[model samples]
Target: MDETTLKENKINQQASTTEHEEFHTQYTTLNLGPTHPATHGIFQNILTMDGEIIIDSEQTCGYIHRAFEKIAERRPFYQITTLTDRLNYCSSPINNMGWHMTVEKLIGVEIPKRAQYMRVIIMELARISDHIVCNTVIGVDTGALTGFTYLFQWREKIYDIFEHICGARLTTNIGRIGGLERDFSPEVYKRINAFLAEFPKAFTEFCTLLERNRIFFDRTAKTGPISAERALNYGFTGPNLRAAGVDYDVRVADPYSSYEDFEFQIPIGVSGDTYDRFMVRQEEMWQSLKIIRQALDNMPQGKHFADVPEFYLPPKEDVYHNMEALIWHFKIVMGESDVPKGEVYHAVEGANGELGFYLVSDGGRTPYKLHFRRPCFIFYQAYPEMIRGGMLSDAIVTLSSLNVIAGELDA
Candidate 1:
């Protein structure tokens, strides 16, 4: 009785083990980026998927890394803006202006009120330009393309303003070390007014399309949510952090370029999800418009740049005609002027988040050392955590909402 019963029991247990092995699910590894359109940039993610769900993900940066910090060490202060241009090409003016303000801080140059107001207008325009790309792309990822096409035209109009300010459009090496290269021309004012009048209606229509749409809401509402605590822990700033119900804006916390003079609300959201991120950026665009209006109305009466002729290039006409102006222009452009021996850090509320520049000058034309606190680089570290346990599609929308510009991420 004992031998026959024991053999039968062991055979039953073996059958049970075989059945368990047969029914178990097999996981798949997928490469989601580094050239994929859904990724939006040169970023790669190795994802472990359980069917359509992402269980784990590892991000790979440096695919577009160009060693911007080391390059800054070699280039002069004036030349560094060109490098910043590539950092956040979506909002190149903000990068350009941030670098200019950093050098201005290091050299103790006080930017004039008029110049500051002009900067506010340009930076806010850039912020709007950036949000247009991000929010529209989020819609596109959710299978809504009409809004993207509708609002992208306004982004081009904003680029037109940039072209009028400086000759270039994208990657504009726009402002000078002390202030802007030139004041706003009458045509620039007309363009700004035209944009101010026309853009709001188009933006409102774009918002109407996705802000309350059932499909978009279902796709983005709870996807890739992070708490305020985790967002702060992950070093989030800008719309991403604000979406987590944290209202810490670099412009409000530490005002620069006369941001303190402007009165505007900082938009915040309760959930750090894709929808919240999109909404926060939408509201911020409105606030940017408000700030731009205030700056334009209260425009100060003065020169476009600061009084530091040593750093500011002389007028083009003066350079061609006057011998002294020619020498000064040559000296400034060639980085022949000596820089102060000091260290300074300056940050601006960039389109993505807080873009900081830490500069060390040892009485040299070029920076002794330079470091950029790129928000995309910092916040992209949290991508895996944010997308864990969510669907593969959700990851795409999440990345788009975060506006993780590849240039800034790999800079």
Candidate 2:
């Protein structure tokens, strides 16, 4: 063929490609939510689409902003654990542990073996709960309300355990300065065992119901695939990063609270698509249950708290009977506890991702600066990239897939 013939063919191919754009010119764009049921929390996502296909997406934040960092800076070192609870409300226990561990590092305080084991057990349970909610919500967004009812029931059981341990359920500040507020009680033990015995069937039913459904697979399988490399560059961790085929779990890479002792697999995805994320999280729930069971069995017999009475508060009996104890309690509560002058970063395997506390102290009760390395913030950043070529409807599924809680993202 002549050069002019080749030029004409190239021009024709370009025209054909432009003519067949997934989002057609006639269709208009629609913004999904900074406040939609599918969005879980306060998060605004701007979606441009033609019919069902989404051409572009933009996620907006600052809706649930609490200025947690600024508040942390003003609070005492020990008091910051409460702030951590607000980071990922679904996984407050892990966030509480992360904040404590960072302060523990600065003070060179060693958490007891049982405390470490307990932290692992509780945090893993939170992880499983987090994944279950994300998956169930994704299912609900895709018109599978049955999945929501079944999974939410299981989630209620988990919350019941949390509420039993602490007075609150969702925002559980279960940790003390060096250990737990109290030891796991017999009642707490009984409820956990009862739930454990029954949870497997519910979990299996959840899988059998949705995992094999043709419509669910078709909606998710090849949609919103982000590459492992892109995921890393975007600074994603936890389940989101795992779905991208990078087996970089913080629990394994940087084990805190004796997580290295546990035996488990880090499930990785091949396509980094929505299907892989769903499967990866499902498998993780199984693994988390295993870890919880092991921790319960291997719980060491020792003190539930550390001997640092000055840093930690005195027991209730001592407070009532002893003048020294009363004086000490008054001092600690009044921001008179002298925290060491140092800066530390502690990262925990939160339900969402890496819930870290970057704290700087200046030998005072209050922190000089406090920064949180929120997982939802990083995971949600991949929104536009994941949905750039997918449909607008897929945004609902994709938002659930990312499992972003707006409180953490906005904070």
Candidate 3:
């Protein structure tokens, strides 16, 4: 090694020694993931525990690192949308929108009003699905698989809505930088409307079946509680942070894609514990329904893409007859269109927490850097804190309540 490399290594070693001296605690260490089924993805957590209470912890990752930023650097603007779907695959559309919106902002694309409303409707639908999966997993971890079944069935219906929209489910690359690939099919709308009508009955059944169970409450209530002050200090947001009694939501605090046009309530909890987090998601589902209803009520009439013929393709008829239209269509489809040079960070309300995309552009057809601010990643930081001093059972409830997805967390 060169002198510079040797010097850097020495500095790192000294830093490690200093940290160990200052932060040392008498506790046993445990490695919790990287293959654990309940980890949700490829994640490994190092825990520092003093018998039943945690003293400190460190989270180690990169087990499933595909170097997403490096991959995005090689893919075209449109191609990158598919990759974003895997970032937080449970709410793939939301991830898809965040990536596209940053690119759209860079290129100064003003999407049509119709497309904006469409994005809002589908995004809210995805949020509902994401939360249901998370909340149900909480039940499953706590030994209430019945709630998991009911909730999973409802989420399956939501996935059907996705399949109807784009002929694909899970990794739905349904949005674009300029606009959408197409409008929702009549059948898509009919199914969503039908699902909306039946949803209340299902939600009521979910509540009746799970929420009031004495055994369930005994497991969840007041167990593994974190103070509201500590949660804010930890950079938490979305339903998890809101459950700590701070009514901050990305959709309301920082509205995007016409979210401000819709009215909805933000749910909060007095105790920053597992049960409160569960309650927050359950109530937010109701608020999401309110958002969807309002967006549907005020749905408008207009073109899907704004009239950017170069970036947004013209109609097929125009493409066939007009030379300029043909050239532009070919350019966009071939990923040769010149997107602007800049960078922007955008986040939406994802199921687990704040799902953000920090994107950089080089005025080329492809992105320069793509980073996801995954909520599960930070929730893992509080793992030792959450399960410390609580029973081993509390560890299960705490993990489930955080709603960490290994795919998302590892991403």
Q: Residue 202 deviation, candidate 3, in Å?
A: 1.1
RMSD of each: 7.5, 6.7, 5.5
lDDT by residue for model 2 (1-411), tens: 363354445444544678654544453446577577667788876665657877656566898788888887788777777777887887788888887888888888997998888778778878878888889888887889998898898888999988887777888887777888888889889988987899999989999989999999999998888889999899988878888898988899999998888888888888888888899899999999888888898889998777776678898899999999998888878878777899898888787677777878888778898888888887788888888877777777887888888778877
lDDT per model vs. reference: 0.91, 0.82, 0.79
Candidate 2 local Cα displacement, residue 293, angstroms:
1.1
Estimate candidate 2's alpha-carbon lDDT, on a 0 to 1 scale.
0.82
lDDT of 3 at 318: 94
Best by lDDT: 1
Worst 10 residues of 2 by lDDT: 20-29
lDDT of 3 by residue, 22-57 (tens): 765334556667688766667666555556665445
Candidate 3, superposed: residue stretches over 4 Å from native: 1-30, 47-58, 313-322
All candidates' TM-scores?
Answer: 0.94, 0.92, 0.88
Clashing pairs in 1: none
Model 2 — TM-score against the truth?
A: 0.92
lDDT of 1 by residue, 23-127 (tens): 665556687888998888899988777699987777878999999898888887898989999999999999999999999888899989999999999999999
lDDT of 1 at 195: 96
